[model samples]
Target: MLGPGAADVAFEVNGHPASVHVPPHHTLLDALRDELGLTGAKRVCDEGTCGACTVLVDGRPTYSCMTLAVACEGRSIETVEGLAHDGQLDPVQQAFIATDAYQCGFCTPGQIMSVVALLRANKAPTAEDVHRAVAGNLCRCGAYPGIVEAALRAARARRR
Candidate 1:
C-alpha cells in the first residue's frame, strides 16, 4: 500500500530516490513518463499485452503500465536509459543497434530488457531459446529476426 495523501508517492527510480504527487489511480508507467520524464518505457496496449511498458523492477522485467506506482515503494526500477554506463552502451544495446534489431523503435526498450533478462538467465541459449525469450515483446515493424540475431551476438560477445 502507498503512504498517505494524493501527493505522496515516493520510490526509487534508476537508483535515484524520488517522491512525486500523483493521483491514486495513476499507474507506474504514467508516473514514470509524465511525472518523472522517463519516456524510454513506451505506453501502449495499456492492458499489458504489448509489453511496451516493460521495465526492470528489482532486476526483473515487469509490465509497468499494469503496475501501480504505490507497489514500487522500495523496489529498484530500471528504464532503458539505465542500461548504459559511463556514456557507453551495454553490449546488448550495442548489438541491437548493430544488428538493426529495432525498426520504429517503439518496442526496442522492452525487447532489450527482456533479452537482458534472458541472457542473464542463459548465457548460451540456443536459437530456439532466443526466439522464445523475445516472443512476448511485439514489434510492429516485424524485426523479430534481427532481434534474435542481436541477442545471439550479445551472448557471444559476453563470452569473450
Candidate 2:
C-alpha cells in the first residue's frame, strides 16, 4: 500500500526511537496518531490555528499538525505522554489536576507542552510568562485562570 513519495522517517519520541512509514505529505500529527499510536497530540484543528497538536521538538514547542513527519527526522519529539516518568506524573500534570487547570481537557496537552518548554527555559516564570507561553493554544472551556495558577504551582513544585 505504499504510494509515491512514501518513505520511512526515523526519530526519537518520548525517549524511544521510532521509524514510521508515511507519505511525504503526511504531517507529524498524522504519523503520531494514525501510525505510531501516540494520540496525546489531538487533531482538533487541522489548520494549525489551534495548539491542540502541540509537541516539543528538540525542547521547543511545535504544532505537529503543521509540521511534516519528514521534517522531524533525526529530531526529538516529546508529546504529553513523554512528560511523565516511571509511574510519576510530571509536576505540570500534577499541578493541572490539583489546580483544576482544564475543562473538557481538549487543549490541555498542548498547553502543558508549551508550559514545559517555558519552565525549561525559565524555572520561575511569571504569570505574564505563563500567559505568553500558551497564547497559541485555544481552550473553549475558558479555564485560563486555572491554567495560569497551575503553571505557577508547577514552577514552585520544581523549585522544591
Candidate 3:
C-alpha cells in the first residue's frame, strides 16, 4: 500500500515503461498529465462524469480521474497520445477527422479511446455498439451523430 506522501509508481504507458513519484491521493489523470506530460486526456469534469479523462487501463476503458495513480502500478495504460505510431494516426482518429466528429474537441480524445477499446473487443461493431462505447463520453457541442458515424467508419476501415 502506498503512503500519504509521494510514492514511486511504475507502469507501462503507451507501450513504454514509465515511473512517477506521486502522492497516494494523486489520481492517474494527474500523474499522466503532470508527471508524464500526456495532456491528451483532458481534465474536464474532474468528477469523472464527463469522461474527458477516459483512458485504457489494461485495454479497458477507465476513468483516469477516479483511478488512483498508485492503483495503476504494473498496469498497461493507453492514452490517446499513444494511439498513433510512425506518424500515422489510428484508424479511429482518422475516421474522427474524416467524419468531423469533433467541434471544440475537448471530448474527442476520450471518445476515440472508448471506440478504440470497443474495436479491440469487437472489430465489427454495430451502431448500438458504437453508441454504448461512447455513451460515457459527453460532447458538449452535441456531436454524437458524427462521433457515432466515425466509430462505424473506423470499424469498417479496420476490416480492410
Candidate 4:
C-alpha cells in the first residue's frame, strides 16, 4: 500500500503515459520539473498567484504549482514543452515570437499556455476573450499588449 505521504500517480503527459512515485504534498509543478525534468513550467510565485507554472490539465488552463501531483492521477497534462509537434511550433508559439509577446521571457510559457487553451476553445477570440484568458498570468515586463496581439494573431492564423 502507498504510504501516508506518498503515492504512485498515473497520468498522461503530452500524449504519453506517465507513472511516477510522488509524495502527496508534492505539487504538479514539482513533479513536472523535478521528477520529469520538464522545466517549461517555471517556478515563480509557487502559490498560483503568478501564472508562471501554468499548464493544461484536461484541456483547461491550470496552475500546476497549486495542483497536487497525486490529485492529477488519471488526468491528462500538457506543458509548454509539449506544444510542438514534428519539429513545428504551435501556432500560438509562432505568434508569440512574431508579435514579440515577451520580454525577459519569464512569463512567456504561462501566457502561451493560457492563450493555447483559449484558442482551442474559441478558434476566433476577441480582445476581451484574450484578456479574460490571460487575466491570471502576470507579465512583469508589461508586455500585455504584445501578448494580446499574439493571441489574436494566432487565432487568425489557425483560421488559415
TM-score of each: 0.92, 0.97, 0.98, 0.97
**Residue 34 miss distance in model 4 (angstroms):** 0.3
State the lDDT of candidate 4 residue by residue for 1-160, as single tens digits. 4556777899999999998889888899999999999999999998889999999999999999999999999999999999999999999999999999988999999999999999999998999999999999999999999999999999999999
Which candidate number maximizes TM-score? 3
Tens digits of per-residue lDDT, candidate 1, 84-152, equal 989999999999999999879999999999999889999998889988877878898999999999999
Residues forming the 10-long window of minimal summed lDDT in candidate 1: 1-10
Which candidate ranks first by lDDT, i.e. highest?
3
Ranking by lDDT: 3, 4, 2, 1
Q: Once superposed on the true structure, which residue ranges of model 2 sit more than 4 Å away at CA? A: 1-3
lDDT of 2: 0.94
Pairing residues by index, what is the TM-score of model 2? 0.97
Runs of candidate 1 exceeding 4 Å displacement: 1-5
Tell me model 3's lDDT, rounded to 2 decimals.
0.95
The alpha-carbon lDDT assigned to residue 59 of candidate 1 equals: 83
Model 1 lDDT vs. the true structure? 0.88
Query: How does model 4 score by TM-score?
Result: 0.97
1 or 4: which has the higher lDDT?
A: 4
For residues 53-141, write the lDDT of model 2, one tens digit per residue: 99999999999999999889899999999988999999999999999999899999999999999999999999999999999999999
Which RMSD values do the candidates have, in order?
1.7, 2.0, 0.7, 1.0
Pairwise lDDT winner, candidates 2 and 3: 3
